[model samples]
Each structure stands twice: as C-alpha cells, then as structure tokens.
Target: WLRAGGIQGRAILLDYASWATAHSIPLSPFTSQPIPLAHLRQLIAERSITIRRGDILLLRTGLDAALKRLAPAEQRAISTRSSPDFIGLEAGRATLRWVWEQGFSAVASDAPSFERGPVLGDHADAEHTLHQWLLAGWGMPIGELFDLEGLAEYCAAEGRWSCFFSSVPLKVPGGVASPPNAVAIL
Candidate 1:
C-alpha cells in the first residue's frame, strides 16, 4: 500500500548493539528488550542518519538470527509462551509520537512484532497496539522477521545506514499478509 500511495523513499537501518550481544547468548531469543526513545535518538545522531518524510525505517534487533540458532523445541516453547516478549520499540505515547513525527512511510524490524511484546501493563492507551496505530490508523506498513544481519554488517563496514529498499509482496486479492520479498542496495 505504501508503494501504491507513492510513499516509497530512502531506507535507514538502525543496528542496535544488543542484537550482537543477544546472539551470543543461546536462550536470549526467548525474550526481547525495549529500545528506548532516548537511545533511538542517540543512535540516529551517532550514525548521522537523516530522517525524511516517507522514508522507510529498518530496525535490526537480531531476533531472526537468534531464533535460527535455537533448537526446534526451544523455538516452539518460546513461540507459545504466555505473554511472550521480545526486544522492540517500547509501547507508549512517546514511541507513538516519535514514529509519527519522523514521517516514515513504513517500519520493518528483525523482531517478531515491530513493538515490544507483552504490552506494557501501564501503557496510557491500552486499547490500541502499535500495530493498530501504525497499520490501521496511520496506514503505515509494518514488516517483521526481516533478516538484516548482512545488511547491518554491510552498513557498519561502510558507515552508511541509508539504502534503496524495494519489496514486492505476492499479489493476492483479499490477502491480509504476505512475505516481504525485499532487497536493499547501498
């Protein structure tokens, strides 16, 4: 929908160090930490990433890679955890505002959901999830389970966070979701 709406633009990758640290721990895949707004701001500044209207934001949380390392049983167990958790953007007004203020056309991450799981018990707005706001309210497309390890490494080596990202989803009428056949070019 973003493409159809002419919302495509430069893509920026946010590579958090936690991804690497968590990958070294075998059981870390079962849980995720929250990416604070302050930390996000610092990362953007430190990486010299310039946010523009309609840009696509790709967050590298390493959840995909970590899950790949887990045993089948471990994966199944984590998948069914009550109130499952994973590292992602924190749930709050600040996060919602940050995303809106940035004017991103879409947001993608290596985590399962774009936002932290087991939604915060004290969140001001309990009725709506980030998914609801981003996808339903803002009409912003959200991508999850993206394999960004290679992209992150390349960006780090070249010190370039922005890229030309293109994705082609299966054209299925009435389809609610489809795999993201995506590519990123520096």
Candidate 2:
C-alpha cells in the first residue's frame, strides 16, 4: 500500500446487515458472528451480483453504524476489550476457497478485520487468515473499519451494489499500514 499508494477499481458492496435483518438471520456486530458462505451466496443471488475478476469486495457488517449508536461508555468498553471481537466473514477453508476462486482484486469490511476478530484463535491456527490467504498468498489488499453507512444507503437508494472505488493511503515509506481514505461512486 505504501509503495503503490492505494487501490482503486470496481467495488461491490454486499450489505449483509440489511440482508440478514430482512431475512431474519440473527447477527450482532459486537459478538463474534461468522458469516457463513451459504448466506453470502444467497445474498449475491438475491441482489443479482455478478462476481467478476479484479473486483474489490466491500462487505458491510454494520459495525460502523452499531458503534455510532452506542453510548460513550459502552463504546469505550468495546474499544478497550483485551480480546477484541466483532462480527465478520467466516474464517475457514470453504470461505477462503470461495474467495480465491472468485478472483477478487481486494477485500474490505466495516468490521475491524475482514475475517472475525481474535485472529489468533481458530482463524490463525487453521491457517485461514485474510492476512495470509489474501495478502501474503494471493497478494490482495485488505481494508477495515471503513465508514460505510452512507455508502450503504446510497447503494440501496440507487438499487446497485457495484461502484467505482478508490482509496488514498498516506505515503509513509516502509510503513505496514495506513488509514485509508476511501470513496465509492455509484
């Protein structure tokens, strides 16, 4: 990211929060809810998403909006957790296989991490990490904690999921990560 500056391309938003709620698929941003592959495929089919190579997958877990609604003290409690946890895509073989086969250029989410938090547990031990699978293995970029509430609404209102996405990352030479300034054009 530092060398290349940032990533930009056709981005697709899978508003799992809205879909799950409408379908009555229980989910919470605070707990460690692993979004199963079946739900994702179902979501794609329902939304008529045509998966394509080099597409950037932008997943909305509703974490950003959820945090905003919390009281200050409750928000602090979450931020200060020693074992930070949040809802995210499932971390396992099936999901990883699907991600790879889909040939996404990059993946991002409103959650803290693409795959569930507490990456050290089954996520790391099983060797199904986005860090390893997407970044190291497939050389795909990962995004997290993006403010996407407005984007979600715009997409819904526009009745589209795909967008022209771009990001401007701080040019900190040799830095590992930078907060991404991202935008999506419907």
Candidate 3:
C-alpha cells in the first residue's frame, strides 16, 4: 500500500507525441511497445531536456487522446477487458540502473501503469516488475493515469521539459492512495 502524498518533486515531461500520433491501434496502447533506454536517452538529448536529482519523471504515452477517440461503448468495453496492454518503460536491470543513476524522485505516466502491462517473463533475481522495484524495493511512489497532454504541449512550446511541481494528497490515516492534485509551473 503506497501513499500518494509521499510522491512530490520537480516535474519533467518526456513527450512521445509524434510516436502516438503516427500509430493508431485500438485495444493496445501505443502498439504495446517498450521504450528502449537508448531511445529515451536520445529523446532527452534531442529535446535538450535536463534531468536533475530528486526530479519526478512524467512520461506521456498519449493514451488519453487515443482513448477519447473511441466511442463511449468501446471505451467501456475496453476498460473491462482482461489482460490489457500498453507501451511503457522497459522493466529490467538496465532500466533500474538508469533510473537509480538519474536519481528520479518518483516516476509517473499517462498510461494505466508505469511499466508495460501483462508483464511476462522470468525476471530471475530482479523484482518481478518495475512496480515492485519502485514501490516496494525503492520505496518510490508511482502515479498513473496522469493528464499529461496539456503539460506535454506546454513544454514543447516553451522548449523546456522541467518545471516547478507540487502535489498534495488527502491526509487520510491508513489511506492506501489519494489523488495527487498535482500542479506544474513553468
């Protein structure tokens, strides 16, 4: 049980708008691809995005826009579908090393989960999934279903990925989770 209020830090948005726009496959989010670490690094360098220690990483998978295009009935049906899948950061030792080295305070994404869903494979000594590594192992909070479209657009227009971010969760004792109520300021 992770507390949402504990997760707060400077926010940075990694926009994959182009990728999402070009691909329009329903049922699977962003075609169920895993964002390679190299590609991620390339994006940061290309965009001149600077990541600092203790910063929160906000990944924009563009799932929100994709979902909105679906009919309400379709959306409802998809929502209830078992074994849903989506594109997200890869879960592995390399990814863990990168995140640890970069010193991200926490990681959040617009997708359903921070890491790709239906995670299948033998992850030997490593944690079964990124969710386990981040939340249980690292004690880092993970935020999902974030509305990052506006932020991604704003960052793109401004040519800045970093922003002053703040979040406050409801102070409920023994609460497992709460709305982030997060805000970002340029």
Highest-TM-score candidate:
2
Report the CA-based lDDT of candidate 1 relative to the real structure.
Answer: 0.78
Query: Which has the better TM-score: candidate 1, or candidate 2?
Result: 2
Model 1 TM-score is: 0.85
Which is the winner by lDDT between candidate 1 and candidate 3? 1
Ranking by lDDT: 2, 1, 3
CA lDDT scores, all candidates in order: 0.78, 0.86, 0.75
lDDT of 3 by residue, 1-186 (tens): 224345556888887654435344323474456766776787787878889999999888777878888999988987787656677777878888899999998888888878776565442224547888888899887888888888888887888888887777677788767787888888
Per-structure clash totals for the candidates: 3, 0, 0
Q: How many backbone clashes does candidate 3 have?
A: 0
TM-score of each: 0.85, 0.94, 0.85
TM-score (C-alpha, index-matched) for candidate 2: 0.94
lDDT of 3 at 97: 88
Cα lDDT of model 1 by residue, 38-71, tens digit: 8778778776889988899999877787788889
